[model samples]
Target: MKCPNCQSENADTAKFCKKCGTALSKKSINHEEMINSMGNTKSGDNTTKIIIIALAIIAVVLAGAFAYMFMSGDSGANDSTSNTAPAAKNTTKVNDNQEKTASSEKTAQPTKTSMSILGGSFSTGSADADKTYAQIYVGKENAGTDVIVQIYYSRDGNSLNNGNMVPATVHNDGYLYITSADAYLYYPDHATINLYDSSSNLMDTQSVSLSPRSGTQTF
Candidate 1:
């Protein structure tokens, strides 16, 4: 037997320790119960450590997953922006090319040539009764010095003076005049004027009718 309050030897049949005067019992001296309690406590501590380790691992895994997702999202956004940038650039380039093509076509067109007779008149020489003259106000565009003007006279739709062409002389006031020296006419009632360019191409024509007058007249 052993004392419960203090470590001491006693007789197997003794109820109390002689050295310490402590009563001993079989239940108090049982070593197996103490060993079992120590084992249970150690097991509980191990279980707690395992739970904490598992929780830490789970937290680390979650953080890693979140970081990967964030990085992937950023990469996707960058890729989208890169792709859109090229498309926008290509669109702008195509628009510029189209505008340039239209501009070039417009620039390639040729200018038109124009010539016209603005006004005209008919006259007779006072000194010579058989001689008549014609005068016209000429307006022209892109014309040169080689441009020519001529006139033919008639009476009552009947050709006179054999439909002779009377060449005209240009004046500083933008008027062309046919002198008696060019053609001789006697009381002409109608006239035809023709204009030609340097290339001998007929540019314009005009007709005039003369009212009965004593001398010079405008038509």
Candidate 2:
């Protein structure tokens, strides 16, 4: 051992220094104990510092994960909202198109009118036996209106004299009739009678055969 007061070397069993006559055992033991305590303190401080650093790193990682998850959830909600907006707009457009289609269908309906021809006949005139006459019966819709009749006569597939713009008159039977005594000199094998309204619009046409006088024509 070495004495602390005189810096002199001594035996391991000596309790006092030889040159300074000072105690050596207690001083050496105290110095060794102080060094051990300082080493333990340093070791404990290093361990605490490492644990604190590890905890800080863990806290930072957890915070970043939470923030990422929050951002992701928010982005998902925004995307859903954006997607729903277009769907709603599409639904509205479809509804508008359906309404427009229904409106067009309603407007495209045809109108109803009351204009028609009932029947007609071709016969010899009673007042003038040698002349032929045509009688056309019109519907009640032509009442109080002037009607014109045109006759197209054909004999043995040959076209003959045709009568046009023959005015009709209403009779006691509450119907309009067309009579033309000089419509044709000879009886026609086939005759087509065309009736026109007051505006000169062709209303109806009828084919008649005058070969058999006994045959009565009906609509």
Candidate 3:
């Protein structure tokens, strides 16, 4: 026999341990109790394992659901982008081609006039409410019996066509005048004045030139 309280060896008929005063029991009964306790412990272990497996399965299911939601949203965005990409590319190509074509256009030429200058001048003077005083001269005399002055500066893009001509004073072999104007006229110096016959035919068919002189205002 063995003492149950102290796990000590003892005589089979002993009611208590001789050395430690502990109770004794049969070996068969102890063995049976140990087997039963081992069975109960194994059952408890199985229950704990089942609980842990259930929690793991739930975690896996939640993770899979979240992954599905993320993938679906990403798929929708990709579909929208794919649909718009082709149109955006086409528009870019069209704009680039238009820019290249516009850049290749030809440049234009400018028109020129056949204007001749008889003489030009800048002098001191002023104008009234409707007219301005101008100075004009010619380097050579007209060959024809009579000559008329046609002061043709431009006004508003057309010939001054005031249709008025100032007659040369015909003095000292040089033509001089303090004329008037209602047209495009400026006198910084060297302005182009045209010489014409009474019928407005251009004179000085051979050649024409200008000379410089100082100016003064004559009331």
Write down the lDDT that model 2 would get.
0.70
Clash count, candidate 3 = 0
Query: In model 1, which runs have C-alpha deviations exceeding 4 angstroms?
Result: 1-23, 26-29, 110-113, 117-156, 159-204, 208-219
Q: How does candidate 2 fare on TM-score?
A: 0.50
How do the predictions measure up, each by TM-score? 0.48, 0.50, 0.29
How does model 1 fare in lDDT? 0.70
- The whole-model lDDT of each prediction reads 0.70, 0.70, 0.54
| Best model number under lDDT | 1
Q: Residues 1-219, candidate 2, lDDT per residue (tens digit)?
A: 777887688887889999999977744854555788999999999999999999999999999999999999999999999999999999999999999999999989563222455776666533322455556666554456566777777777776665667776445453765555454445567778777766667877777765633234453
153-175 in candidate 3: lDDT tens per residue? 33334443354666654334344
Measured by TM-score, the strongest candidate is: 2
Query: Candidate 3, overall lDDT?
Result: 0.54
lDDT of 1 by residue, 16-126 (tens): 789888877755654545777999999999999999999999999999999999999999999999999999999999999999999999889574344677887777755
Position 111, candidate 1: lDDT: 44
